[model samples]
Target: MTSSEPTSTRRRLRRLWLPLAIGLVQVAGSYGAYRGQLERREPDALMVVLALIGPIALYWLRQRPVLVLTATTISTLTFMLLQYPYGPVILSFVISVFSAVIAGHRLAGWVAAAALYFGHVLGRIALGINEDGIYQSLAVGAWFVVMVIVAELVRNGRERSAAVARTRKQEELRRAGEERLRIAQELHDVVAHHISLINVQAGVALHLVDRQPEQAGTALAAIKEASKEALVELRSIVGVLRQSDESAPRQPVPGLERLEHLLSRTSGAGLEVYKTSAGLPHALPTSVDRAAFRIIQESLTNVVRHSGATKVGVHLQYGGTFFELWVDDDGNGVPETVVEGNGLVGMRERATALGGTMTTTRSPSGGFRVTAHFPLSAEDERDPD
Candidate 1:
């Protein structure tokens, strides 16, 4: 069975103590006052016993409300019969009505209320006590109704507050995810171009180093310049996420025109990449361009981190309505358990948020493959009437 939570424990303690403490103090004080009224004569032993029992019954009010109320009513009625005061008994009845309201049992509370009122009528009539009759009963009944309504309203308001808190938490998570994607796009753009130039120059220096030492020196200088540029661009790319002002120059992020640059960066990372495109377009929406760029970047990052392969392949197809990206590495393949690193999970989240699908599988030659398909733009997604 589920145990009581902390809030419930506190509520239970409050419910148990309030009725017992208040009822006992009032009953004792009333008994003392009545005893003083008959000081010259000996007090009625039975009236004193009934007064004590009425308060003692309150200890069980929360655990057994009906039984405790029944015991209280019997003792209070007996005290009235013996000509003791009715005020203490009337106070106990009011407490019982309030307890029943908060306890969520309207039918039971109403029945208990009716019984207490009838007992009051009997005690008053039997002892011929001249006091306000119908007015007193109606006042007590109204108190019960008010307490029940307040309890219900409090319960509903708390539920509404909790629901609002849950929705706000979900919105926060979604916004955080979007921020991460934006940062990823910025990093991809900042690094791709300079790395492209680095790879081109590196290849030229390596090819010309022996043929002509003089020309090779110039080519090697170009390689050094290219590598330094690549590092500066990389630092600036990473600095976007930092609150620093050591800004480096930035270049426009490669769009469709810069797919070659993307390929160059992969080659500079010492991984040969082959890319094929079909039905290529001139440009894409910024969001789609950013997403596509990040997906390819993450795929290559994973290859560098996990895929022990010398060569990778990238394939892109633009169908106007949608586009596809495929990256495959001839690594020893993903592990059988398919546990995902943060980069892989981020790529999947991006694809899913854009209403795209990403699939990862092991290729036949012990390699890893990733494919993502995304819509071209929001305008492309709207249905025509």
Candidate 2:
């Protein structure tokens, strides 16, 4: 907690000084009235003045609620023992009870109120104020009971407000967790896919320089394309994370329609791929399209990095309510030493978030294969783009 924060003493006094000051004035007026009612109207100069300052002193320690209540109770009992009338002298003690209850000291407040009320009544009667009448006695006790009830109500409201604040904080934390997972998935897919392609194309350029000088240009061109796309997508991710209002356009994340760009780069890495898409190429939802593109991009990158596959096949099929993706390569199947990697986990998470499934297995053609199926919403259609 910083000194400038609201919890600091200066801020707390600013917020609560109003009610305490009002209560102090009320107590002072009550003391004046009690002195006027007595036969010996001369104020017992010391106790009367102490009663006036007692509540104000307690107000300064409003942060130490229990101490405020306890001190006020002692002061009130001392005033009564001196044969003081049932007067505004007790008003400060009531305010203390309210303070303690509102501070979540409910049990202590109730116990203090009970003890002080009886003590005041007993002291008044012993001093002959009760002999005045039955009506006066009933009225004094009733007022004391009302103060206790009011304090309890204030405490209940404070507790309810605290409960609501706690619930809202928990909800915010849950949303933050989901957003962090999504960002992590995005970084893994973008970096893994682009870096793998660059690594393969660079190797191709190096190998062909001596034997096929002209083809090296093609490999370098593919590396350039892959790096450019990676930069754009990474920029979009950064724009989403930036706090400033001034930002670059980040909409339209990559989709399967842009899959040819990835394929061209993969081909440059010396992988021969046969691609087929059935049905008209109607557009898909950004979420579904992005996931599909990333899934394919990752699968091909894995093939280049781990599968040692030279020839690959990719199939895309659209249906009324769902779309399917399949990628297979003719290579020495998935190696037994291979383990599930971050790319595979990222792809599966993306599919599941879109209410879909992604699966991978050893293909019948003696290579690895990956399949993804995602349900489509009406929003998936993008006006034939």
Per-residue lDDT of model 1, residues 1-385, tens digit only: 3466877877777766755676566566666666556632234656556656756667677787777667766666566555565455556655565565556555666666566657666766776865656888678668656655665566467668888999999999998777777676555544543454455556667777777667767656655765675676566656766747875547655344566766765575567888888885546666567667778877876776567788998888878688898898899898778987666676787788778988899876679999999876557544311
Candidate 1 lDDT (Cα, 0 to 1): 0.67
Can you give the TM-score per candidate against the true fold? Answer: 0.48, 0.82
Q: What would the per-residue lDDT of candidate 2 be over residues 129-152, giving only the tens digit for each residue?
A: 645466776776687788878878
Residue pairs whose backbone atoms clash in candidate 1: none
> Lowest summed lDDT over 10 consecutive residues: which window, candidate 1?
376-385
Which ranges of candidate 1 are over 4 A from the true structure?
1-122, 130-143, 166-260, 270-274, 280-288, 302-312, 328-346, 361-368, 375-385
Instruction: At residue 103, give the lDDT of candidate 1.
Output: 62
lDDT against the true structure, per candidate, is 0.67, 0.78
